[model samples]
Target: MRYEATRSRVEDYFDRTATKTWERLTSDAPVSKIRETVRQGRDQMRERLLARLPSDLTGRRILDAGCGTGMVTEIMAARGAEVVAVDISPQLVEIARSRLTPGLAARVTFHAGDMLSADLGRFDHVLAMDSLIYYHAHDIRNALSVLGERTQENIVFTVAPRTPLLMMMWNAGKLFPRADRSPTMIPHAPKSLSRELEDIGTLADLGRVSKGFYISQALEFRV
Candidate 1:
């Protein structure tokens, strides 16, 4: 599928499955072992992301790109950071807004739009967790360039690793599509992301989080 078509499909899928996705990300409600394992992995990723941030985020500005259901947004707000949370799926954005208390909501400004194209102004940091796996290589570069421009300190994002085993699993998923039709996974290499940061005159700090049934890589760009 073309990039635009894939993007559209992803948006539609997320919009329709927003509730289920939220549960999968942040719920301990009874589930199969595989589903529980995936949740544990996601929790590890969240912990790693939080650990990489500054020790004190008080009064700092943050951009929570692809802030589905505001999991990271809520945590940042609790730390006294001002957050601008944006998501492409309006349904997910709505759920995020609903989850926030009035005080926490006051600390966040939500935008329902594409992170690459949004003029959300600059921030001390940008967090794009588990979101870039949907983009093609060129678009990933573009998104990183935009993020580099809008971040004053660092930009952190996760991508599915383009390893042989993971790639094979991704291909196999295409044979038996999910009923809700999840987006096609576009795995990325750490080297390609590093090169993109170099092209934009930034530094890349890469790290891996391997837990449960998932292994994701995070890239932090410093300008």
Candidate 2:
């Protein structure tokens, strides 16, 4: 599959929204009555993710996969954790670099390359925030294998949620309607994901997670 094509489409789509969209993503919920209405859903999701973080993340070396626009990277950096952030979009890399303060940039290294290609070194936590969803069930399996080669501590997986095909298609059009705009090919089946992890390089197991924004799952691995 032409993964680069899909990356190009998503980068362009967000570039067009860089000014407004990125800020909306990075900031706290607005205070005004009307403005607060917009923050309800995603704000809740972010809180859920925050609550789910491993309790011992402080001072840990972390990998922020698909650290688009660096929102999550900056968060981890603020927590005083050493973070290496990566993304496939050069445009987002540029934006993230420009947006980061020098002090924050010092602790967090932002790279524009495929996580599948980059040797980002070992990290206590490997975070794939809304990332692996772009690839197929097998491609995600392959990515997990690559992660296994790198990190031995734990792997953090955050997806756009797994849902029925009809709902997934509706979401593709509603949330990400760019070039191909449809995530029809990305597998959301639980057994497929479990099987991919089996007999592979990493020891992956099903784990507990609070679901929203398409039922995010974390497959913690010890390699």
Candidate 3:
């Protein structure tokens, strides 16, 4: 099943993020204009999320799991946090490295690794914005384990979910009786959170927030 966002292999999906997603997302006439449009408009809605986070990020060690083009990384840096930005794509890392604001760039360290298997050391905070949705079940579980291992105080992440995929799938089955099987348009109900992301932190509901143009739920856990 392929997601239209980057149209990459589920195995090599992270690698695709290294390409022209930056310029492509920032431009007006980009091919994936619909997705890019929502992301550009994401700034306004990010306020509620920021309010739910620590008051000051000054001197805090942060990990941006899938830093992409450093969009949110800029905000963390502006707040005086030392950021370690990692992405699966070298191209995206290169762009982020070049686009850095000298001061922020100096504070940021970049790495390219698969979140599913990377061994990032613990930090004051760990973040994986809208990136984790690419992972299915086991991958999500593994990511939580890694996050728990690396966070000293908190872990904040977002997932774009609507009801649950099972219900959505049932509805689609009724609507399109003869349609062929295809990729999922959404994710499933999390059977467990407290159990899965346990031991290392205290979990809090960051509540619902917007992503790109879509509504999503943000979850935070303190280590």
Candidate 4:
């Protein structure tokens, strides 16, 4: 039930509390220095994740799990990949749809629902950037197991790497009022995460990115 609980918190946070804030952060709009770091870190992480995939994605079917604003989805679609982009927040999905590139619209489908839904069908690859960061290791493993069951080639995702700085931030974030705080990020040691995922796939620590307040580690699961 941890997954469901965390998922609900995430849905609420993005759909209601921070919708506009995220919309701005993911855009070129000017933001505070703290938020700018997050924006930059996310941009770098996205490129790193995309670089792991084939450059020529023609005929590939990809699932952009937690596809916020469709940045990754759009890029993949532009490269000839048919991307099924799913986000927990309906508002975000709508924004993604509205901002989709003209011709690339046909290459992507926007869905506001669980990314793990089998109804969305199988995929050749799955990209879940910063999506699994809120869940505990067990839940992360379970989520990966579900996605892996249908994915053919690779599952690339990210986690908040356990570190002194991130730990301090995690502790400090708890001081915020319940109504204003984002869902708590549960950091994971790469080795521990890998052990939990061993039965699910061959896990690899692709790398980590840290910029000011934002920190995330890219991981690949070969199925």
Residue 129 shift from truth in candidate 4, angstroms: 0.8
**In model 3, how many backbone clashes occur?**
1
Specify the highest-TM-score model's number. 4
User: After superposition, which runs of candidate 2 have C-alpha atoms over 4 Å from their true positions?
Assistant: 2-5, 16-20, 28-41, 44-59, 165-187, 201-219
TM-score-sorted candidate list, best first: 4, 1, 3, 2
Best model per lDDT: 4
Off by over 4 Å in 4: 175-177
Mind sharing the TM-score for model 4? 0.96
Better of 3 and 4 by TM-score: 4
Root-mean-square deviation (CA) per prediction: 2.4, 4.4, 5.4, 1.2
What is the C-alpha lDDT profile of model 4 across 61-159, one tens digit per residue? 999999988889889999999999999999999999998998998889889999999899999999999989999999988888999999999999999
Per-residue lDDT of 125-194 in model 3, one digit per residue for the tens?
Answer: 7777766654554455566766767667667776655555444654685465333432233453433554
| Alpha-carbon shift of residue 100 in model 4 (angstroms) | 0.3
How many Å off is the CA of 102 in candidate 3?
1.7
lDDT per residue for candidate 1 within 96-192, as digits (tens), equals 8888878787789999887766578889998889888877777777777777777788888888888887789778878874664577678888787
Q: lDDT (CA) for every model shown?
A: 0.79, 0.63, 0.62, 0.92
TM-score per candidate, chains pooled: 0.88, 0.72, 0.72, 0.96
TM-score, cand. 1: 0.88
Per-residue alpha-carbon lDDT of model 2 for 1-223, expressed as tens digits? 6666656555565555454555554566354554454344434444544444565467788888888777777777878778898887677777788777778877888888777664678777787766776666666776777777777566766543355753556556666635445333353655556666778745443433432323444454555
